[model samples]
Target: MKKYLLIFLSLGVFLNACKKSDDDLTPDKGLTPDSEEVMVQDFMWKAMNFWYYWQADVPNLSDTKFPDTVEGVEAYTAFLASESDPGVFFDDQLLFSEDRFSFYSDDYKELTQAFAGISKSNGLEYGLVKFSDSDDVFGYVRYIIPNSDASTKDIARGELFTGVDGQTLNVSNYIDLLFGDNDTYTLNMADIADNQVTPNDKEVTLTKMEGLVENPVFLSETFEIGGEKIGYLVYNGFTNEFDEELNNVFGDFKSSGVTNLILDLRYNPGGSVNSARLLASMIYGTHTDELFLRQRWNSKIQSELSDSQLTDYFADKTNDGSDINTLNLSKVYIIATNASASASELVLNGLAPYVDVVHIGETTRGKNEFSLTMVDDFEGSYVYNPERENQINPDNQWAIQPLVGRNENADGFSDYTTGLVPDIMLEEDLENLGSWGDLNEPLLARAIQEITGVTGKRGFEVKMPLLEMTNSKMFTILKDNMVLDKKLDINIQ
Candidate 1:
């Protein structure tokens, strides 16, 4: 029940002010709305009108599209009945063509749980890469969640799978084969060579369970190499609930007298803005007085908000008020990939103005626009409020995570839509995706090389470039998002 800065899409909040500033967001709930779809459509339109970042740009979402009266309600009833499915209307009609990350869900319960890192998963977080020159795809294990069905099976990271059940995986059947309605599936293992993939004798069966909570902190260890105490953390997501646990990892890093840190955000897709801020605070010094990030909503919101209300500052403690462990380093080495997005990108961008961020991986997933979580709670201006959950229309379990703002660092730079380019270019080698946290791993090896000026210790060669087609986490809501959180509680104009 974490409260988010009411937004939509995959954008994160840049609310500088987490203060509560209520506005008169009372929308016409459609006095004589046609049907259930009309009701949901009415809610969607109103939410977008007030909070959507491109509301001004989307002609359909224009403030003048409908008057703020009973006639507007009648228009909503009449116009919405033309479309049968709310999801279709949301996608085809309401969303902007340029919008890449905005999304709507039928079930707010599942969506919120996803933001909390809870979902029905086999525990295998994998990425699908197309074979050298064929449409045929091979899946490689990224990481596994503790106590997941995959965790119990005989599977490990860097393992390759060419098929599901008995069918060979390809560009078309993979959706139904892997993420389809079937609860249980067997992964047909494979062996990789010079661009050739061959099926092996091993098969691992995994079943999806209810409410699998994954800890974003995959691994945290300090390495003593070349007279430098370096910390390596493989953080998968920015799940807010696990913020305390993530903070504790830094606490351990702090105690170990680690001067250098290698933040492995190669698998992270993003989570809470607060969590990202906290992580930034941990890496950089917690200067509550200094700015961390800022927000730029639609012009209407921009006009309504004061300068301070649009900016967020670095915090000295967690949301729970525990003192944050700060490294206060001048430079940090970051491990990124195409999967690194949203809040993951935020940490690097936000810290760039302060700390020297050495990005060492593929180009990141470009999702800078921050979104908010909104239910059908119109009285609260479409903002999802935990205290007002019961008040939310029970008939409307639908929720919209819309792009409401662009999150910029203190210097007002959020233009990474194409993606944040890396300082060092390196892609994951599929032929030898070495063990996680091991120094011999390609990404880590490069980071260590940069740290201690040791190059020849670990082989740095790209046997075969991993051309990623898709991934497991990308299918989830975690992919390509920088959604909203408490920062701007400004009084809506």
Candidate 2:
């Protein structure tokens, strides 16, 4: 089956800097757009224009047209003015609210094109595609790209995308074309049903494994290659609670006989910056304080890590007789992929200075921006509701919040916006995911080769559908045997 995962853009402080106050008695009108308010308003207008053009169902626009400077603005303005039948006027007082919703015709087109690419890439069977406008609080249209012919289209679908003006775009379709379609089918799942491949009989064929044990605490699962010790562990998400869980996971690894580690952050989409610091503390040892994740705000120089609550995170560096400064590993292999993003990239890039790092996978999604804390003025109570919001409130008067105080990396580096590239880059055979586990694909194969000095057979490239339809027999099994296992204890009363 083909899965359609949605691509999301996080709101940076810069994103929310445009909360204009109509209530202001003295509003400065500058011809040469200078202040943050202008940028924000311009951003919203441009975003609207993007929707207008996309919905025209015309050809895909060039990426170069993205507004970058004052000159670009003149060009866009001229384009709009040149249109004889300007459907939407340049000076049209367009107000974006949470109530109305629509989709950029082009966004849907892009989604269609992406789906076609994914279908061809994964060799999946296409089903009927449907699109509809969303009735969500935030304005957006939902598009459902199904994998099978029978899947139903529900208004209640998936994620929402909001423009800079707080106008949200609902998924007209339930499938996030990037992940998998609801009704798509993959050759592997099809083959498994047809009895083409059998399970790996629990035969532990993987033998040789080597890597530095930076976070000595992650040795919970023992690999046979190390001759009987839980040397390495791999987890997906770094949730808010992961801070404490990570310490325990790492601490347990050290005492359990894990001398090395290989952190596999292939599909981690990122969560919890504090958890990221907590992860850093394990390998950073004592000097973890020095490694900065970066500063937010326009005047980054004014920010410092000590100013935030995430400070002294590794405050108790002394664990048993071993401190962060004293703990050392031989080598660290960070397994990555095109999907490894945000917090995942943070760990990979943050620990680069002190470790012998090896990255294996496609280029990572570049993202840098922590959620800001927002204090909204509740009506006229003079009470600012303090809450940690993803971006700044539309109202400029509200305060911006951040977890990391500093504006740089732990290595004293700056400008960490585009994300980091790995030292040893390895492309995975995309087609192989059908026959093997997600991490057991070519990327991992290459990482293992680099770490263990083994030159195994090259992996075959096979494209599988992003999503597939498993019958109720399989679906019931998944819900009962898989999803539930992670939560409730089945044996409990």
Candidate 3:
């Protein structure tokens, strides 16, 4: 049965690739070189018209405005070709004022790799915290990858850096010093004294690598407290490739007879929808046939899609055919921050109807919409070839991840534009930092207190009033396609 299933999957992929290749073939129209460019422009417009969630807001994409006739196609294509850059021209048509997730990428290869949890990095994820009443900034290491150069150099989480390559970190040079194009640089460590961070004498040299696979499962453990087995999972990203690892963690939780779950998504930026659905299934347990999420596309496509095709249901197994280790719990605790978005929000929203979700920490990032990547095939069309497993356009090197749908749960509740409010709003205790997976950690501690009905002593207080300041600069590094994601594939093929 498993062998037959594998064959069926392979055949499906083959048929989809063949269909995409046939779709890419353009009609033989005797036209000039400029007209060829116009055809590509038309391709972009049509793709957006059929799939974009905000298609109604885009006046240029309306079928009545740009019909599929020779006159309409010629006029629209000529206008699009007049722009200096077609990519920029495509961006102008999107509803940027309200839709911030839609983005254009010059290289689809890089974007596709990013979706698979692979990227160029020194294996450091940090947040820049600026001291109040001063221009000095400190880089706080969040986590490091296991095989990265930074990990080899003995860089640990919660370690602060005051300078880069001996240059002081100020507002002006912070961006360049941290995000500069240097292959190797020295990090001047900082010392925390009297609730303040200052430059220390220690320095560590680090080198950046080309491809690093980001391990999304940071930590997972089952704890015994008051005869109840509590499972803790610090999941950072929703990358689909890591679904097997995620399921394995859940398998351990099931084996230990976990009664409650604490899902840590404080630093997670969302990824794939398939992984999110699998996770929802693992948590809810009995909701396999229930609606997990519904994607409401633009009016044109919405009318064409059946009810079943537009919605995603909970599944008993992961994408790999392995049985999911479900908890079957009535309540669960989720730790979130402003960084939690997309699939993160999807899990929180989708499970609300069935479970008593006790959301801790800060408000969510408030992105209720999802995006689909559209790449150019260089043959004046957007192809959805399954042969391109990662769905990357190797030819033109151009792609657009546009907001293709707004997601809703079984209750049809999708009004979280601002953000989902936390049940208990407590700031992250960075002043008295505790290691992750430690039950004494502030966020995890509070969750344990709620579970066991026990109030433990709090961490030592520090006199850092300025640490409460919201650092907008911390989120600057995440302003890319990495932040935007989808609930499912919108490709018709």
Top candidate by TM-score: 1
Selected candidate, larger lDDT, 1 vs 2: 1
Output the number of the lDDT-best candidate.
1
Better of 1 and 3 by TM-score: 1
Clashing pairs in 3: none
In model 3, the runs with Cα more than 4 Å from the true position are 1-44, 60-93, 134-136, 378-395, 459-493
Return the lDDT, model 3, position 87: 69
Residue-pair clashes per prediction, in order, are 23, 57, 0
lDDT of 1 at 137: 84
For candidate 1, the clash count comes to: 23
* lDDT for each residue of candidate 2 in 340-382, tens digit (9 for 90 to 100): 5566766666666666667766566554443322122212111
Evaluate residue 88 in candidate 2 and report its C-alpha lDDT on the 0 to 100 scale.
Answer: 33
Comparing candidate 1 with candidate 3, which one achieves the higher lDDT? 1
Go through the candidates in order and give each one's C-alpha lDDT.
0.83, 0.36, 0.71
Give lDDT for model 3: 0.71
Candidate 1 per-residue C-alpha lDDT over 368-396 given as tens digits, one digit per residue, 9 for 90 to 100:
98877889875566777666778789988
Q: Each candidate: RMSD to true structure?
A: 4.1, 17.1, 5.2
